[model samples]
Target chain A: MSFPITLTVNGSAREILLDDPRVTLLDLLRERLDLTGSKKGCDRGQCGACTVLVDGRRVNSCLALAVSLDGAEVVTIEGLASGGELHPVQAAFLAHDGFQCGFCTPGQIMSAVGLLREGHAGDDPERVREGMSGNLCRCGAYQGITEAVLAAQGATARREDAA
Target chain B: MNRFEYVRAGSVAEAVAAGAAPGAAYLAAGTNLLDLMKGGLATPATLVDVTRIPGLSAIESLPDGSTRIGALVRNSDLAHDPGFAARYPAVAEALLAGASAQLRNAATTAGNLMQRTRCPYFYDPASACNKREAGAGCAAIGGATRLHAVLGFSASCIAVHPSDLCVPLAALGAEVEIEGPAGSRTVSLTAFHRLPGDAPERDTVLEPGELIVAVRLPPEAAGFAAHARYLKVRERTSYAFALVSAAAMLRLDGGRIAEARLALGGLALKPWRAEAAERLLAGRAPDAAAFREAAEAALEGARPSGEATAFKIELARRIAVRALERALAGTPERVPALPASPFSAPLANPLPSSGAIAHA
Candidate 1:
C-alpha cells in the first residue's frame, strides 16, 4: 500500500511518498516539508491555528489528510510573502497591530487572506468580524484583526489578491 | 490519532464496494471525521477517500424544477449559490449561521447531514454515554441537562442534534439519495435520522456501506422562499451552537395562512418538524394570536427532561413564535450581518426575548 502524491505548494511542485497514511496536511507541512510557520494550537479543527489555503480555499490543515490531496495546490503562511516585500495583508497586520503575542499571527493572516479572496466582507467591520470569527485571538486582539481585514481588503482588491 | 489505511475511491461504485467493508469509513473533507478521531470517539480501520470522486460536487437544477445538491459540495458554496439561496433562503441562512467560515469551507453537505451530536458526554470518552458505548449509562441524564433535548428524547439519550442546516432542510421536505453496495435508494431527510429510543448508537438508518450521493429538494420547497427564516438562539452572538432554533416558513393567501412548515433544532434528537402546529395554522391568519396557538401546538407534548431545561420549554415556545413572526414579515432582501441570530436581524415585532433562563 504505497501512497505517492504530488502537490503544488507555493507554486512549487513537490512529489512525496508517504510512509503513514494517517499523516495530515498539518503534519506533512511541518514535519516533511519544513513549513513550520503554521502553528499547531489544538491539532484539531476547533482552533484556527492550523488554517491554510487548499486549492484557493481556506481550510483547517489538521483536519485534511495528506493522501486525500494528491493533486491539490496548498499555500501556507511561509508562502505568503514574495522576495522581501510583505503581502498586503501582512503589511496591513503590521500597520494595524493585529497581533499581541504573535502566536496566532500566521493562521490569522492566512484566514484574513482567504476572507479577502472570498470577497464577502466589504469595508463593513461587522461583516469582517463575522467572517473572521473562525480565527480566535486569545489575546483579545479582535478589534485590530477586524480593522486589519477591513483595511487589507481595500488594498488587496486593487491588486486582485496578489498573495 | 490512530493510524489507519486510506483508499481514494475513484468512483461511487468503488466507494460503495470498499465503504461496505467492516471498519471502513468514507472521508470527504475530513472536517468532522478527523475531529472525532482526534477525540478518540471514532476509530475506523480504513478511510475511503471520497473527496475526489467524480461528479459528486455539482449543484444541478433538475428538469422537474427541483434542486439537487451533491453530497461533496462544500457548505460555503451551497449557501453562497445565487440560484439556490434565492429559492431556499432559510437553508442558506441556516448554513451561514453554522460553524466558522473555515469549517464551512471544508465541510460538505453529506458530512453536515451525518454530523454527530455535540453532547459533552459523547465527546468525553471517559464519561458513560449510550451514544458512544452501547448499553453504557447516560452521563448527561442528570449532568449538564441544559442543552439536552426537550422533545423526542428517551432515557437512553438526551443528546440533541447539533445541526443548524438540518432544521431548514427538514422543514423544506428535502430527500436524501443513497447508494449502497446493493443498489440506490432515497428517503426523506426527516426520516433519515433515527431518534434515540432503545438504541442511541445508531444515529441514522443507513446500512453499514450506504453512501449519501446527493440531497434533492422538492419543487414545492421553493414555495416558502418568500416567507421563510431560520432563527438560531445561541449562547453567544456569533459562531456558537443554538440553545434552541426554529425554521419557520409560511405561504399566505389573501392575508390568510395557506400552509405553514415549522421545524426546530437544539430541541430534539432530530430536527423536530411541527406538522401538528402547521395543521393548527393552516386557515388562520398570520397574526400574533395564531402564531401563539401554533407555537403552543408545536410544544404540545414537550416536557423538560430535567431541571436545567425547564425554562427552555418556555424559551422554545417563544422561539417558535419569534421565528414564525419573522417569516411572516417576509424574507430579508439580504442575509443580515449575522446569519440566524434574532438580535442580528431587526424584527418587525421582536418577541421580547425569552432568552437565557437561569437554572439553579
Candidate 2:
C-alpha cells in the first residue's frame, strides 16, 4: 500500500504522493524532489553519503523511510546556500581543499554543519575528526575535511558572537 | 524491500494493535530494520511506525533518583545529555563508541537493543544461517569465526549481539519496560536478551506484538556512576564493531572493593556479565593480583571455536582487567585532553604503560 507524506524541504512546503511505503528519504529527494545533492553511495546506513538534516539533526537519509516522517523539516545539501551565497561550511570546504572527487562533499558539509549546530565542533582537530567520522571520503581528504570543519565552526562562532 | 502497509500509530494501544497483525513489525529509527529489509533478511508485510507515539521519547528522572529512559530516545540525545552522562558515564560512553554520529542521531534506545547481528553469513541469503532462517544449517560454524561468539554459543548459531549500549546497560542492572496486548510489564535488562539455544532465530524473550516502552535504571546504580568505565577495542579507531569490549563499575571503600559489576561484549552471544568476577572482587583490595584473578574468573568457561577467535579469550581478559583498573581510578570530569596526533597513534598498541600485562 502507498503512503502520503508532507515535508518541509529546504524551507519550502512539499506535498508528495508516495506510491510505496518503502521509498527511502534519499530516493524521495533524488527521484521525486530532484534534489540530487545527497548521494546514494551504499544505500545502507554504513556510509554517510546520504546524510541530511531532519529537524535540524543529522541522520542517514538512506535508512529513513519517507512515510514515517510526516511533518519533519528536511534540509538537504541543496538547501545550504541562499541568495547565490555559499554556506560557510561549503565555502570552507573549498578554501581548505576538502574534496578531490566531490562525491561525498555534500554529506561531509551537511554533517559538519550539523556538528557545529550540535556544539560538537570544538577547536580540537581530533574531536572534529571524531565528530565527522560518519562521512567517509575515499579520496583520503580527511585531513582537509577536518581542517575545513574547524574553520567553518570558527566562522560560525564568530558570526553568532557578532549578532 | 517488500511491499508493506504502513501505519503511523498515534497511541500506544494503536501501535500494539497494529503490531499484533500477522507479519507486522514496529518501526522506530529504521536503522537496522530497513537495512535488513533491503537485504531480504527480513520481510515484514506491515510496518507500524511508532516514532510518533507521544510520551515514549521522554527522559524523565524518577523520584527515587533513578532515570527512566524512553525507548524512543535517540542515541545521540542520550549520549549528549550532560545530566545523563554525569549520572551514567559508562552508558553514555558506550553509546558514543557504538556507531557513527549520523547513525547515533537516528538510532533509538530500543532499536539499538533490538539490532540484529552483523554477521556476513546472516546477510547472505544463499548462506546457511539458522538465525536468519530457522533450521537452514549453520554456515558460520567454521567460516570466518573471528566476529562470531566465543561464549554461550550453540552449534546452530554463533552470531554475537552487536550492541555497545547493551554492555553497560547489562552492568547497570537496568529494567526494560514493555507494553503488550495484555498490559505493561518490566523485565531485567540481563534477562531481556537470550542466548542462542536450539532456536537461534529468537533473539529476545519478549512475546510477539510486545513493544518496549522504557528502560528504568535502579537508584543504586547512581552511586557507582562516579567509578564506572567503558573500554571498547575494535578493528578501527572509530565507527567499527567491537572486537572485544568491557564495561566495569566499582564501589570502593578506602581501596577495598565494596561492590563490583563487570560485563563483556563481542565475546558472547549476549552481553556477558562477569558474576564470578564480581564475586571475586567484592570485599577484596583493588590490587593488580585481585584484578587478574577477577579477569581470569570472568573467562572461566569460555570456549573459542578456532585460532581466529582464540585471541579474543586473552583479549577479553586483559580488557576486563583494564576496565576495572580505570573504574577504580574514578571518573574524570571530562575526557582527558587529547595529544596533537591522536589518530596517527597505532590502534594495536592500546596500552601505553610498559607495566604488567605486556601482551596488551
Candidate 3:
C-alpha cells in the first residue's frame, strides 16, 4: 500500500506516494519526480552519488527510504540554482575544474555546500580531502573537486564580509 | 524490494511492540537495512519507523559520569560530538573510520550495530551461504575468502561483523540498553554480538522485536600514562574496508603497563577481544618486548582460514603493537566534546575542468 507522504523539497511542499517501505528517496527523486540530478552509483552506501540534503544535513539518499522522510525538508542538486544563477558552490566547481564525466558532481557539490555551511572549510588541504572522501568519482577528478570546495569557502567568506 | 507494511512509531514501546510481531524490524536510519533489503539479504514483512519517536536521538551525559547515546543518534553526530571525543575517543574514531560522510549522516547507532556483513556470497542469492539460508552449505569456506574471518569462525559461517564502533565498545566494557515486547534488559557489549558457531544466521543476541534504546559508556579514571589508538590497515587510503584492524587501549605506569584492553576487527565473526594479550600486559611495564609478546599472545589461538589471511594474524599483531606504542606516547582522542557540526568541509581537490573550475 502506498501511503501519502508530504515533505518540503526545494522550498516547496511536495507530496509523494510510496508502496514498498524499502523504496529509497533516491528512487523517488530519480524515478517518480524525474529529478535525475541525484545519480545512483552503487545503490549501496559505498558510493556517494546519491547525496542530498535533509534538513540542511548531507545524507546518502540511496540508503534512505521515502517513507522515513515524512515531514522532512529535502534539497537536491536541482535546487542549487537560485533565480537561474548557480549557487556559489556550483560556480566554484566550474572555476576549480572540479569535474570531468560529472556523474558524481551533484553529490560532490551538495556535500561541499553542506561542508561550507558547517564551516569546516579551512586552509588545510588534508582536512578538505577527509571531509570530501564520501563522494567518489571514477573519472579521478578528486584534485579539482577538492580545489573547488576550498575556493567556494573563500568566496562564501568574502561574500559574508561584504554583507 | 518486496512490499512491506510500514508504521511510524510514536514511542519506543510502540516500536518494540511492532518489532515483536513476526517479521517486523525497526527502521531508524535506513543506511544498512534498506540496502540489505534491496540486495535481497533481508525481506522483513513489516517495518516500524522509529525516527519520529521523541527522545531517541539525544546524545546526553548520564549522572554516573557515563554517556548514553540514543539509538537513533546518527553516526556522524556521534563522531563529531566533543564529549564523545574526550571520553570515548576510540568510539568516535571508529565511527569516523567507517563509511563516508554522506552514509555516516544517515546511519544510526542502532542500525550500524545491526548492519550485516559485506560478504559477497551473503549478498549473492545463488550462493550457498549458511548466513543467507539456515541449512545451506557454506561456499565461503573454500571460495574467495581473502576478506573472510581469521578467528572465531566455524564451518557453518565465516563472515565478519563489519562495524568499527563495536571494537572499542567491546574494549571499554560498554553495555546495550534494549526494550522489547517482553520487557527491558541490558546486555554487555561483548555478549551482545555472537559468533557464527553452529547457527551462523544469528548475528546478535537480540530477540525478535527488541529495540536497542541506548548504549552506555562507563566512566574511566584519567591519567593512564598509557595511550590508545585504532589502527586500520585497509586496501585503500580511505573509504576502504579494513583487511585486519586493531583497537588497543593501554594504561602505562612508570613506562610499564598498568592495564591493557585490545580488540581485533576484520578478522573475526564477532568483536575479538585479545584476553590473552591483555593478561600479558597487566602489571608489566610497556616496552617493545612486552608489546610484541602481547601481540603474539593475541594471535596465538587465531586460526587463519586462507593463504592470504595467514598474514592478517601478523598484521593484526603489528597494528596492536604500533597502536599501544602510540597510546603510550601520547593521549588518544576519545570522542569529540562538541555537538555535530552541520557544515561540510572541503575534503579533496576540485576536478580539473576544461573550462577552469570555480574557486569559492
Candidate 4:
C-alpha cells in the first residue's frame, strides 16, 4: 500500500507518495529523489556506505524506512556545499586524497560532518579513527581519510573560534 | 523489506492493541529488524512504528536515584548522557563498543535487546536452523562454532546473542518494563532473555504484542560506579563482535570487596551472569589470585558446545580476569578512546566531578 510521506531532503521540502513501505531511506534518496550521492554497499547495516544525517544524527540510511521518517530533516552529501564553495570536509578530502575509487567518499564526508557536529572526537587522531570506523574504504585510503578528518576538524574549530 | 502495513503508533495503549494482531511486529529503529527482513529471516505482515510515541524516548532520572531509560532512547544518547555515563560507565562503554557510531545513533535500547542471534547458519536461509524454522534441525550444532556459546548452551541451539550493552545491563541487575494489551509488568534483565531450550525460536520471554516500554537501573546499581569496567576481546582492533566479552563491577571496602557483579557476553543466548563468582569475590582482597578463582567460578559449568569452540572457554576466563582487574583499577575519568577494546589504554585525565559521581 502506498503511503503519503513528506521529508526535507538537502534543504528542500519533498512531498512524495511512498508506494511501498519497504523502500528504505537510502533507496528513496537514490531512486525517487534522483539524489544518488548516497552509495549502497552491503545494503545491510554493516557497511556505512549509505550514511546520512537524519535530524542531525549520522545513521545508516540503508536500515531506516522512509515511510517511518516522514517529516524528518535529512542532509546528504549533495547538501554539504553551498554557492560553489566546497564544504571544509570536502576540501580536506581533496587536499588529502581521501579516496581511490571514490565510492565511499560521499558517505565518509557525510559521516565526518555528523561526527564533527557530535564534537566528541575533537582532533585526537585515535578518537577520529574510532569515530570514522563505520565507513570502510577497501582501497586502503584510511590513512588519508584520518588526515582529512583531522584537518577538517581543525579548520571547523578555527572557523568557530573566529565567529 | 517485504511490503507491510506501516503503522505509526499514536499512543502506548494504541500501540499495544495494534501490535496484538497476528503477524505484527513492533518496529523501533529497524536496525536489526530490517536486516532480518532483507535476509528473509523475519516476515511480519504489519510493523507497529513506535518511534513517534512521545514519552518512550525520555531518559528519566527518578527521585529515588534509579534511572528509567525509555525503550526508544538511542544507544549513543544513553552512552553520551553525562549523568547516565557517570553513574554507569561500564554500560556506556559497552554501548559505545557495539556496532558503529551510525548504528548506535539509530539503534534503540529495546531494539538492541530484541536483536536475534548472529549465527551464520541462522542467517543462511539454506542452512537448517531450528531457531529460524522450528524442528528444521540445528545446523550450527556442528557448523563453524568458533563464536558459539560455551556456557548455558543447549544442544537444541548453540547460537549466542550479539550485544555489548546487555552485558553491563545484566551486571547492573536491571529490570525491563513491559506493556501489553492486558496491562504493564516488569521482568529482570536476566530473565528477559531465555536460553535456547527445546524452543530455539523464542528468543525472549515477552508475550506476543507485549512491547518493552523502558529499562530500569536500580539506585544501588550506581553504587559500583567507581569500580566498573567492560572488557571486550575481538578479532579486529575495532568495530568487531566480541569473541568473549566481560562486564565486571565491584563495591570495595578499602582493600577488600564488599560486593561484586560479573556478567559475560557473546558466550550464551543471554548475558550470562556469574553469581558464584560474585559470591566468591565478596570479602576477599581484589588481587590476581582472587580474580583467577572468581573467573574459574564464573566458568564452572561451562562446556564447549562443539570442539571448535573449546578455546572460547579459556578466552572467557582470561577476559573475566582482565575485566575484574580493570574494575579494581577503577573506571576511567572518561570512556576509553576505543571503548571496550583491550588495546584501549585508560585515559589519565581526571573526570569532571559533575559527570563522574553518581547520586546513588
Evaluate model 2: give its TM-score: 0.96
User: How do the residues B199-257 of candidate 4 rate in per-residue lDDT, one tens digit apiece?
Assistant: 98999999988999999999999999999999888888678888899999999998799
Query: Least lDDT summed over 10 consecutive residues: which range in candidate 3 chain A?
Result: A118-127
Off by over 4 Å in 1: A158-163, B349-360
lDDT string, candidate 2, B90-168, tens digits: 8887887878889999999999889999888998998999998889998988898888788898988988989999998
Tell me each candidate's TM-score: 0.97, 0.96, 0.92, 0.97
| Model 1, span A26-113: residue lDDT tens | 9999999999999898887777988999999998899988998999999999899999999899999999999999988899999999
Q: Each candidate: how many clashes? A: 0, 0, 63, 0
Higher-scoring candidate on lDDT, 3 or 4: 4
In Å, residue B26's CA in model 1 sits off its true spot by 1.0
Which portions of model 3 miss their true places by more than 4 Å? A161-163, B221-226, B332-360
- Model 4's chain B yields a TM-score of 0.95
How do the residues A1-163 of candidate 4 rate in per-residue lDDT, one tens digit apiece? 6799999998999999988899999999999899999999989987799999999999999999999999999999999899899999999999999999999999999999999999999989999999999999989899999999999999999999999
lDDT by candidate, in order shown: 0.90, 0.87, 0.79, 0.91
lDDT of 3 by residue, B226-301 (tens): 3655666677656777787777787766756778888888888777888888899999976777878888888887
Colliding residue pairs in candidate 1:
none
Candidate fnat values, all:
0.90, 0.79, 0.79, 0.86
Give the top-scoring candidate (DockQ).
4
Interface RMSD of 1: 1.0
- Ten residues in sequence with the least summed lDDT for candidate 3 chain B: B338-347
